[model samples]
Target: MTNVLSFEWKKEDYVTISGMIDESSDFSELFKKNHEVLFLDLKNIHRINSSGVRKWVLALDKLKDVEIHYINCSFSVVDQLSMVPEFLNKKCFVESFDARYVCENCNTSQTVTLVVGFDIQAGEKNYTDGPERLCPNCKQKMEFDHNPDSYLFFLSNLSNKKKTAI
Candidate 1:
């Protein structure tokens, strides 16, 4: 069975989206109001397709005037953000997201939350310097699973945008 997308409004401007974001997902509510800042929680979003990406990009276009903060983004969402330039607009910011880590000793893998400004620094070459994480099984240091440069590439784009906007 396909997991249908769902949204929960935690506040007037904060909404949590879960399940799969596909062509059928409706984003009409996001464009209904004028908000100074909108917070979107995407930790539960498990999957997204090409049509979904197109639909999401179109929805974001309508929200260009609003400052969007993406919080608790899952690895899937991060993948989209890193791969697609249009996935993150100038008005959008990623507050926090999950990154995959693996322990080579025990072959254990886990996901850790990384806050943009705190855990991640824009110009820093070592993106893995965030909170020290140890593997649950082996009690050994876990290394970042993906390439730091590629997985965190969106930060460079965001940093460049901020510099030009200043």
Candidate 2:
């Protein structure tokens, strides 16, 4: 069993949340209370689903101009986060905030990332865990892996897009 804690508040038209986030209404209702940036805190959260992604998208649509953020999410959650369509940066800032580059060949339909971490500097960079997505069957670098391009892609584009953007 897991203990779930959540955080949500309207800060100048933004719903700030920090805790377990699933396909629950604790957020939609908050949206109804007031439309703002849907700030979701994945920092302490452990799990989520496509349904959770759907909920975030719906909330963003209904609220319009609402920004969603999921911080410090687990790697599994981060993997799912990366695959969500239109989900991007403003909503998916991995703790330690790392940037991942995607291979321009796999086409995103057949890539599965095993581990993720990164380091960077002016005109240079470094990352561990094989660059975000790999072929689940071939053990080779995949060209693409659905959407999200990276975890940050999810937090910034969680609504009205739902697919790879740029």
Candidate 3:
């Protein structure tokens, strides 16, 4: 039962959020203010849920002009969001890479198939961890999958790997 906490902005044009953005968040009010860029500063945010994601999507649609960006998101948040295609597709922002491959050109999501509970490893090993290779669909080199606790670090932000363009 953690309570949601955040700051209210009126004219900063950049909204930074901390704390949990759960059901208690004031999404409606935040959307009404009309910010040009919404920086959901999840730097200190510990977690999020279905309700929170719904609110974010709804607010995103409302704030069509607002360029949304997420910061300091935890691996759990990244994995959860990747699991939800609707939410993943809506976010046109680049992630810090804790287990998602965002196409540089199309911005499409390419998540690794979770090999837990089904494909048990012969020993203590994470199945998600595989050699890095180019995605067959996009032909762009995708980052290797990581353990849930490990954070995926990106070497570069500028990636639009298309064979035609190369």
Name the candidate that leads on lDDT.
Answer: 1
TM-score of each: 0.86, 0.43, 0.50
Which pairs of residues collide in candidate 1? none
Best by TM-score: 1
RMSD of each: 3.9, 10.9, 13.6
Report, for every candidate in turn, its global Cα lDDT versus the true structure: 0.82, 0.43, 0.48
What's model 3's overall lDDT?
Answer: 0.48
lDDT of 3 by residue, 11-122 (tens): 3554446566667767665666656556554445557777877766676677667655554455555555546544433333432323455455545666543221122221
User: Residue 70's C-alpha lDDT in candidate 1?
Assistant: 86
- lDDT minimum window of 10 residues, candidate 3: 157-166
Worst 10 residues of 1 by lDDT: 157-166
Model 2 alpha-carbon drift over 4 Å, by segment: 1-5, 8-20, 32-39, 89-166
Cα deviation at 105, candidate 3, in Å, is 39
Candidate 1 vs candidate 3: which has greater lDDT? 1
